[model samples]
Each structure stands twice: as structure tokens, then as C-alpha cells.
Target: MKQHTLPALLALSLLVGCSSSEEIVPDVPPSELYSEAQVSLQSGNWLTAIEQLEALDSRYPFGAYSEQVQLDLIYAYYKNDDLALGLATIERFTRLNPTHEKIDWVLYMRGLTHMAQDRNFMHDLLNMDRNDRDPEPVKAAFKDFKRLLERYPNSPYAEDAEMRMFALKNRLAEYDLATADFYLRREAWIAAINRCQELQKTYPDTEAARKSLAIQLEAYQQLGLQEAIERTTELMVLNPI
Candidate 1:
């Protein structure tokens, strides 16, 4: 439960500077403001798009393009790599418009945002493998994708969500494998074998599962358990990965 001092998380701790409630509302008309925002958005000017969109949201809170602006802002934040704001925008949109038609898309984007943040500043700072880092964000991303699939099975994002889930599953498996590898290195034979077995049972179709068999075989060999060694070797032969 160590808290990561990531760049995005640090930003989130500070106040949102451009919030409508705090900043003075611009005097531009809704159409003109929205038009400018659209131009910025179309031109790949994410910062400009955010500025214009924030202004539009502030000045004309109930404008015609309100919902579309919210959606566009989410994409803009994502493209800008502003993950914190993207998450914040998605949260607000879901809370305000829980039944919006694009809720599935929002959930998909939420998963993506979490996915993006999984490799945050800490990873780069320490050159740490993701398996050694905190797994919460990736876990959260997997859950978000799961929610999207379960609630919107017919959604266009369903296929992509499934793919993300598959990747996340392997990532989790790697985490489990890391634990088993640690126990093996420490010569905790029984614990290593138990972890490997649990990993194989949980992620039988994953590459990690196949790799776990090798670890289990090694653990059995280390402990001089001939029967377990033979069974694990057979499993490795059958898996062939």
C-alpha cells in the first residue's frame, strides 16, 4: 500500500486551477466559443482545445454542445497525455450523465486512462519492471474494461476491451510469477511451488502459466520431490512454451 509519488498523482493533489467555479467566466457567445474549441480540437491543439472547452463550459454551462464538448475534452486531455484531467472529466461526465449513450465509450476511455498511467513517472525514475511496481492502476484498468464489457456487451469497444483484459491478465500473471520467482530464489521451496500452482490454476491459458510450470519443476527438484518433478516436467512438455 505504498503511495506512488507519480507526476500525475502529484498534479491531482494540487487544486485544479482552471475550474469554472474559481476562474472568471469568459464573455464569448456559446456558438463562437464552441466553434473556436472545435477548430482547436480539429487542429490537434489539445492545450488550446482544453482552454476553449473549459471556457465554454464555464460561460455557457448548459450550452447546446455541452455533452459533445465534454466528450471532446476527454479525448483532448487523453491526446495531451493529461491523464488526471481525462479521468476527472470522465468521472464528472459519468456522475452527471450516467445514462448517456456514450457511457460505454466513457468507461472505455476510463480504462484507457488508467492503462496510460500504469507506466507513470516512477517506472521511468527507477527503471523498475511493471511486475515489481504497484499493480493497482492496472487492476483498476482491468476492472473498468470488465465493467464496460459486462454492461455494454454489444458496444463497439467490446472487442478492444477484451484485448486489454487479456493483456492485463498476463500482466497480473507476471506479478504472481515474480512472487514465485522470489520465493524460489530465497529457497522457500514449498511456498514457491504453492505460488506456481496457484498461478497455473488461475491463468492456465497465459504464457505466465507455462512459465510457472518451469518454476514449479525447479522448486520440486530443489526439494528432491521426484514425483512432483516428473508431473511438472510432463506439464511443461504438454504446454510446450
Candidate 2:
């Protein structure tokens, strides 16, 4: 009986040693996680870096490391082609930590994100211009530029925003002219005259206003309204574009 017990004790000791050797390893250090995130970013693995940085947020929420992680998450979102998310995160940072040294940069990035989103629509409108089409996107682009101008008046983005506004104004004028042209081609004289009149009032400085005047003249003449024709002619001359 003593010999059997000795053999069982030895077997138990071996089992304990094996269990200790196979213990599950713990997670890496916070600093190591940060380093891995940086390396992943450098390697263009933006999504992986975002995951690592996000993990550090709850674990080290008040340290310089945490702040860095939050900042890096914005860049990671941008790099990962999530511009809307990036803009929102950065805007939160700006609102919550207004005194942060990078506030200007955050503002600039937000403006850029909005501009990028606007550009896709603007590009489609410009492409449509070749076929003389809808002006909805052109109107939308102006609204985008207007926001940038009003929100970040002193931002470095202001100059670009101003330029875009100028271009958009011209595009809007052209769209009005196109609408008038469409009405004329369809023999809708009253509609054509109305579009032309709107162009004169809304965009007084555009070549579109000039073309609108010509169309308005023809529409009023076709309707044989002598006084209305003369009135539209005067308005065209007073408001050229």
C-alpha cells in the first residue's frame, strides 16, 4: 500500500508542473501596445493601429499615453478612409479640450473633411455641365463652401473656401442659364422668361444673366407683351450676369 501511494504522489507532482508550464500568458504592456500601434500605422495598417489605440483608452485613460492614443485614433480614422468619423472624433476633442495645443490643426482637418465630402458632389456637377444638366449639386456645393467660410473664418482653410465660393457662384449662374435654355427648347415661353428673370436677380454679375436676357427678350416678344418685353430688357441691362 505504501508503494502504491508513493507512485500516485509522484504522478500528481508531474501533473502540477505541466499545468504551471502551460499557464495562459497575460496581455502585453500598455507601452508595448502603443508601440505596436505606431508600427502598424507606419506600415499603413490603419485599422489595426486604430484597434490597438482604442484598447489603450480605457486601460490608461488619464496618462499622456492615453491622450496620444486619442489623437492617433483621429489620424487612423482619416487614414482608414473614414473621413466622417475622423471629423466627428476630432470635433469632440476640440469641444472637450478647447485649450489643447493642436486645436488649430483639428479645426483645419475638420474643414478639410467637409471640403472633401463636398468635392465629390461638386465634381459630379461639373461633369454634368458637359451635358447641360441639373443644378442641384451646384447649389449643394455652395452650401458646403458657405459653412466652411462661416465656421472657420480665420482658419488656413479660409482661402480655399473663398475660392470655392467664387467658383460656385459662377456655376450657379450657369445652372440658371441652362434652366432657361431648357424651357426655351421645350417652347415653354413663360417658364423660360421666369428662369431668365430669376438669373438676373439672383446672379447679377454672371454671363448666365446676359444669356438669360436674350432668352427673356425672345419669350416676351413671342408672347407679344410690349411693355413686359421692354421691362425685361431694362432688367437685363441693369443686371448683366
Candidate 3:
């Protein structure tokens, strides 16, 4: 009986050791994958690096590999000129992991992405022919910056985002003022006045503030309201220089 008990106990201990070894092994080797991907990225083989990182994410699904892959893919996408993909990935990561260790970096990247897409409409319009009037991309960029400001007010990116937001707001307000000027040239006083009012209420710090108030004052004069003109001129003076 003693001999039989000793053999059974030895087999049980061996089985326990096997289980522990199995537990120690990860589904995917994160360090190896990360190193290979980093090498590929450094060699300017962005697509290859992306594929390896994606493979790790798909096969492992959940592990240290997945986390690092998500983090590193941002650079791969950017260097590959996949700006939309890079921005989207960073945005999703920031949203899902607001308290993650790298949240500051994610927020900064988000702001950078938005700022990168910005183009002055006046500049573009002057460069292009009359056929292109689509302001959607500029508006979308503005929205992206606004998202960073609203979502990550305390982030390191917040101050930069605020500055960009202010710049974009002024640009948008200028766009409106330009439209109002065009309307004024067409003798559409009501339309011009409405656009000026929008600038006064929505974007008081931009160049639009001076132009919009001046336009509004002219509109008030043409429409015959001395009091309105005086009030608008005073507003123009008080607006930021």
C-alpha cells in the first residue's frame, strides 16, 4: 500500500508541474513580434510592419501583444500616408482608454491629426478655380479639433487644441463674413446682415469680428437704423485687435 501511494503522489506532482508550465506560456510572444515590427518600420516597410502587427492582433486577440500592436500601429499608419487610418485608430484608442498610461500621447496625436488637415479656404479658393466650393473637409477638421477640446480638456494636448480651435473658429467666421460681403455686393442686405450677426454671436475673436461688425454697421446704415450702426461700431471697437 505504501509503494502504490508513493507512485500516485509522484504522478500527481508531475501533472501539477505540467499545468504550471502551460500557464506560464503566453498565446503569442509579444516581445518577439514587437521587435520584428519595429525593425520593419525602421526599414520603411510600413505595410509589412502593419501586416505583422495585424497578425498578432488577429491570432492572439487578447494579450500583451494586442495592446502593444495597437499602440505601435499608429506610427506605421502615419508613415505609410494612411492619415485617415492613423487618426481613426488614435481616436478610438483615446476614446476607449481615456485613463490608459499613454492617454496624453493619444490626445496629442489626435490634435495633430486635426491640425494637419487644416487649409485656409481663402488660400485654397484663390489657388483653385470657381468649380470647387466644398468646405466639408475644413468643417470636419474643425469638428475634430473641437472634439479634442471637449473630451480632453485637462490633457496636455488641451492647450494646443484650444489654440487650434480658436484659429479654426476665426477661419470659419471669416468664411461667413466673405459670404456676407459677396451678398452685399449683390445688394442682398438682409443676407449680409444675418451672416454678420452670426459672426458677432459665434466668433467674436476672429478677423470676422471686425469685418462682420463693419458689414452689420453698413447694413444698418443702408437699412436706416442709426442706433444699430452706433451699437455695431462700438462692438467693433471692443472686439480683439
Candidate 4:
């Protein structure tokens, strides 16, 4: 019995050692790793690209391909739908290389990452109102895009960022108006009026501002504030419907 048990134990130990050896991936040189990552990226294998880039970054933090590796990692994360990782990577790159020649591209990618997170495909497909959802990501995306435009007005990405910002502003304004309408429906006339005024102040040129003025007029009438009603009505008239 002891003899049989000894052989079995030896066989089990050998099996374990073989399994560990199989699991160990051979480390590639930084250049080779970067080349592999680029190939993966070109082939649209985002997860594989991410793994190779991350390994390259970790193994050669200041190597020849370090900066390019970081930038590619951000793109890989974004393509993998890892928005948080993508944003964090962008922030790190900006913080580490403040004067990077391609800083504008980084900022543009950051804005794009935020915009990707802000979109809700299912809700959009259902034709549901974005105002009913959390607006934090939308607001963050808008701010990022605004900062990109402010800092890099001549960036090749500026036009696209501006278009996205326009849509986001309207969405944000609509969200505020939706809240004000909620207050109006609840007979919270003072709160409704305050929200409308705030919306008008923040998003003056938006269609939401026009709707907000209309809401304020209704709220003022409900609260019997004749002077306020008259002021809002006059402004709405000048704004043309």
C-alpha cells in the first residue's frame, strides 16, 4: 500500500508542475511586444492589443515605445468598451507628458471616450427621453469637449467636438426643463419658476430657454406673480415663439 501511494503522490506532483509551466507565458522583448500590439490593433483584436500594450507599458515604462504604447492603450481600452480605463489612461498621459506634441489628439480621444459612455443605445432605440436618465456622463462629455475646443481650437477634431457639444447642450437644457416641468406639475410654483430662471440663465440661446420661459410664465401665473409673468411674456415675444 505504501509503495502504491508513493508513486501516486509523485505523479500528482509532476502533473501540477507541468500545469504551472504551461500557464507561464514567455516574456517578449518590449519592441516585439509593441509590434504585436500594433498588429492586434490593426486587426481589431482590441482585447489582445490591450494585453500586449499593458505588458509593454509595465515592462518598459520609459522605453523607446513608451509614449506611443500609452496612447495606443487608451485607444485599445476605448475599443474594448472600457471607458473608465480609457479615460484614466488619457489623464495619466496628459499628466505625465504635459507638453506632448499630440496632446490635442489625447484630449479629443478623452472627449470621445466620455461621449461613448454617455450614449445609451437601448434607451435611444426605445425612443425614451434622455432627460429621464442620469445626466452626469453627458455633462462630463460636454465639459471635456468644451475644454478641447477651448485649448485646441485648430485641432482637426474640433469640428466634430463642436457638433457633439451642440447636441449635448440641447440635451442638458432639456433635462433642466424636464425637472422644471415636473415641479410645475406638482404645483411647486416657486421651485418651478426658480428652475426655469436658472435654465434660462445657463442655456440662454437654446430651444430649452424658450420652453423654460413658457414654463416660467405658467408658474408665475399659478403663483399670481403678475410682474414676473409680464417680464417672461415680453422676453418670449422678443425671442419669437
TM-score of each: 0.81, 0.54, 0.63, 0.83
Clashing pairs in 1: none
- lDDT of model 4, residue 139: 87
Off by over 4 Å in 1: 1-26, 120-129
Give candidate 4 misplaced runs (Cα > 4 Å): 1-26
RMSD to native, candidate 1: 10.4
Q: Give the residue spans of candidate 2 off by over 4 A.
A: 1-141, 230-241
Report lDDT (CA) for all predictions: 0.88, 0.74, 0.72, 0.88
Please give the lDDT score at residue 26 for candidate 1. Answer: 57
**Residue 197 local lDDT, model 3:** 84
Per residue, candidate 2 scores C-alpha lDDT tens digits across 1-241 of 9989999999999999998764432257898888988999999999888778877776678867965777788878876767777877876787778877666556555544544544455657776443255555556556655665676578676787678777768767887788888899898999998888887788877777777888988988999999988887787677665
True-vs-predicted CA distance for residue 121, candidate 1, Å: 6.7
Residue 100, candidate 2: how far off, in angstroms? Answer: 7.2
Which candidate comes out best when scored by TM-score?
4
Give model 1's TM-score versus the native structure: 0.81
TM-score of predicted structure 4: 0.83
Q: The CA-based lDDT of model 1 is what?
A: 0.88
